[model samples]
Target chain A: MSIPAIASTRNDALASLLDNAINNKTKPLGSLGMLETVAKQIGLIQNTRVIALEKPAILVFAADHGVVAEGVSAYPQDVTWQMVENFLARGAAINVFAQQNGCALHIIDAGVNHDFGPRTGLTDRKLAHGTHNFAQQPAMSSDTCATALAAGMALVAELDGNVVGFGEMGIGNTTAAAALMHKLTGIPVAQCVGAGTGLSADGISHKQRVIEAAVALHASATEPLDVLATFGGLEIAMMVGAMLKAAERRMVLLIDGFIVTSALLVAARLQPAILDYCVFAHCSDESGHKKMLDNLGARPLLQLNLRLGEGTGCALALPLLHAAVNFLNQMATFESAQVSEKSE
Target chain B: MSIPAIASTRNDALASLLDNAINNKTKPLGSLGMLETVAKQIGLIQNTRVIALEKPAILVFAADHGVVAEGVSAYPQDVTWQMVENFLARGAAINVFAQQNGCALHIIDAGVNHDFGPRTGLTDRKLAHGTHNFAQQPAMSSDTCATALAAGMALVAELDGNVVGFGEMGIGNTTAAAALMHKLTGIPVAQCVGAGTGLSADGISHKQRVIEAAVALHASATEPLDVLATFGGLEIAMMVGAMLKAAERRMVLLIDGFIVTSALLVAARLQPAILDYCVFAHCSDESGHKKMLDNLGARPLLQLNLRLGEGTGCALALPLLHAAVNFLNQMATFESAQVSEKSE
Candidate 1:
């Protein structure tokens, strides 16, 4: 299947109007800081001065990673499906945050090893029962990877929202993400590796060695899609597809932490303009996330030192999006309020 | 008038229980970062494992500063009452953010130079028409300063919320804040002074000179209340009182930008224990705010470069407070979710 097209959201005509509207709001020039930038970006994306974030949703894709057999993760592989159950029961951090921020959350079982047959609140889009162990071979066949990508795109097409936040839940996926980051960015494998779900210092060292070896083993897989098939998890690949489709439809893509960003790295490689539609939610406390964000030239909105990523960052940051849009739409102009402008 | 006493929120017995409850919440230990810290702080403040932030509110205090005559700010003094009118009309940045975040907003006319005369949504708490210009003399008499503090405490007492966010609107308040910061923290006047509401390089230099002279004039007033009487705006003095009373009542105090932090510096000095109930909302984009926060050893929840102080930072940050509480109360435990913890 062909990747969806994402147009750059840069309209010089609309940019001037958005800037004028934002500047005239009873605030000192640029006093709202990053929020003003966000407002302008949202306006540009919508091609209008009046922007509204309607029916926001977070899509959390869950799967398992064969790399857990290499002892790269601190948690057992079973936790992936178990957490999917927790999400379905609305007892996870993401569920609580999504509910608090008035976001509709959809949990997708992309390729978990356990069978959670026909569960409510769990969308089944399994590409396979997890990818192959990359320590020994490619994580997934190229055909399976393509199918996962297509599945992700199809899933997003069914959702109704102008904004979509991408999150993931897969035991050992961080190892898969780190490997992808190392191969795609050409950053050192050690720099890409970090403690996944609580690793010891020695465990991180070992995980680094595993990713370095895998990256070296797949040296011929230099293309983004090729590298993704070699190292990316099912959830990560699916997210790449969802992100592309969302941007194709001109929806604001709220990007979460490390693993989710790794998916974005692959998606962005295919469609660099996809960056125009992305809103990085936060820089996670997880090691390498800052570097990953820097590699993408992304400046996230929040830096809360969060690392437990079930889209908690996205949910926490949804209000800032609402605040930005509301300020642009609702705040009185200096002319309207009769507030004095800065002294000449 | 006597300042209200604020007790330390330290409860070692309850701290252990809160920590235990937080650690078991179906995620890696301490992965929630600042949210975990905030949750623990709120739990300790409420003295319960079950925490709820009830009826959150943002109180915006507006007053005119006499220091504006010194040309230390970029806007005219009339903007204070104009912004107050903007707030009453629900057409300000604070109004938009507060409404979006489900925060009840209260606009208190602490002492604007213009007569608002019992506006519908504005509280009548004017200490005077405006403050005496601190560049020439003490901003207010000691008696007036004391009355402002008492009025702030009284105002908070009439409110129903268990949380209060303090914001200010005064053309020359940043000058007042700088003077207070320099005197209290012994930070140099040059370091404390900044571009308030968009001052030029020469305007900031002039501001620095003006504040240096005023600090020298008020050098004899070493006590916190005395310094406040000498350098504080009526709105700032009122905020100092409100913060102290809110802490005394065990309510969470959401502290905003430079002006708000100046009020906090005075309140914290009067009752050092007030720090326990306070949450630094954001480190503003204004120069010296990070230094001021550093002096207080505060790690703010957001760093969006926001400098517009109408409690917009507080309104933006209220959702994080809600997220923290919701995660602590709603997330499933590892045992309950049947998810495996870190492997041995």
Candidate 2:
């Protein structure tokens, strides 16, 4: 899958608008909190009063990994199919959170081994029955990685909605994500490992070793696309494509927990501009995510002890994003409110 | 001014209704994220479907403390009056943030030495010209403490609207707050001390000794009322009143920064049920807040290195709270959406 070409904007225009907002002199210096920063960015990106309303949407791509067979996950590989079924049934956390936040849910079946038919509310973009076992070979083919990215970009273009988020579902995806982060950032997998989805201590060590083994195999692959082919999940590639497209369109990306952040790291390394389009939804209790966030130099919107995936954090964080949009659109300026300024 | 008396509800209806929502069986168990928890809690709290609309309001109580005369704050006491002026002009972070988030704001003159007589956007609840310099003597009369709490209670009783948030605007108020927290939590003022609104190292040491001395004097005082009168600022006393009243009325109390939290500690000791009506908005970068939160077992909603007060953090955080409420109210249940169970 080709990364969607991003639309170029005059950074000069953005800079000027940001300056105007910051210099408006309502409160004392730097008093507006993060919204001050968020507003300026929006003004620069949209280059307008912003029309304020952002459509909330998240794409959760699910795929089975060959590594799941290695017992790295607390849940069985069968649970991936089970959870996908639940997602389609709209019984999952992401589904409920989306409903609550008035966000749309797009479930992409990237490469789950189980066949989920049309009745399950899924979009079939499966590249293979499942990824190749990293213990034996590369996780996916380069072409398959490309195809997944294309699938995600195509969906974003087709949806034509605002503010798309990225998330993933698959037993053992965390192990894959941890491996991917190590590949992209050159961080050690052990440092990136944690008790994913309630894995026990033994489970964590096993998972870490599995990830280390995968990283050891994929160490020399320098190309982002090649790295994805070797170690990326179809779901992660799809997420990268989706994230790129959203950035190109200047839509907000409400990024979820750990595994997704690793995918974002890959996407960012490929296209550094993509970082601006991202909004981290939460600092996952998954310890690795904090490091990932630090390396990315990104601040998340929430810090709840959330470890569940399926784009639930994005759904949960949607309302806050909405408020950010609302405030930027509505608040009266200091001059209009006729409030006094602190003496210069 | 009279302390607003909060009323606790007797409905087992919310509890049963939440229990009903959890067992709906259409979604996977624990898939809905915080929205599900909010929905369940609200169902239990309201005994019906949860409905949240944006009438979010912040009452910022401004006062001057005698401690400022001791040169404890980085900025002089006049900044309080200046910032209050900034708030009314809607240029302050709280003003802009509040405006951005679609929340109404009321600036209350609880005990500021400066005059703010009946501005269009301000509520005058002046208790005293300012408390006596606590470095030399008790900050307030215990009766005045009762008066401030009564005033807070009174305001909420008239709030025939939506959620209520409390923030404070007082130079040198932190010394009073940290002192109160030290006495209340039995942590030394050293752990509780921080650079409030920016204090220099020597200024901080001076601030600490002043608080340590105040705590020593205040430690001998018995009863919550006695503690409030001896050590608390008028704005803090008012906030304590507001929190208790809001809790009694089942109105959400959006708590802000270190000083306000000290008032909350006072209210919580007075009525432990107060915490249920509260949402910790943001953990200020102030070191003491974390310890206070830990002691209270409270989790703040945001933590963006915020140290500015005047309810700015709460204002910035309101949108998130709104998001939480909106998701719970708007998301459809499994039975309503015809979604199947995932355990299938």
True contacts kept of each: 0.88, 0.14
Instruction: Name the best candidate (by TM-score).
Output: 1
Compute DockQ for each candidate against the true complex: 0.89, 0.23
**Can you tell me the DockQ of model 1?**
0.89
**Candidate 2: docking tier:** incorrect
Question: Mind giving the per-residue lDDT tens digits that candidate 1 earns over A198-313?
Answer: 99999999999888888778789999999999999999999999999999999999999999999999999999999999999999988999999999999999999899898989
User: What's the residue-level lDDT of B283 in candidate 2?
Assistant: 85
Question: Interface Cα RMSD per model, in Å?
Answer: 0.7, 5.5
Indicate which candidate wins on lDDT: 1
* After superposition, candidate 2 runs with Cα above 4 Å error: A1-56, A76-91, A99-104, A112-126, A158-162, A209-222, A248-252, A318-344, B1-57, B71-107, B114-121, B160-163, B200-223, B249-252, B315-344
State which docking tier applies to candidate 1. Answer: high
TM-score of each: 0.99, 0.81
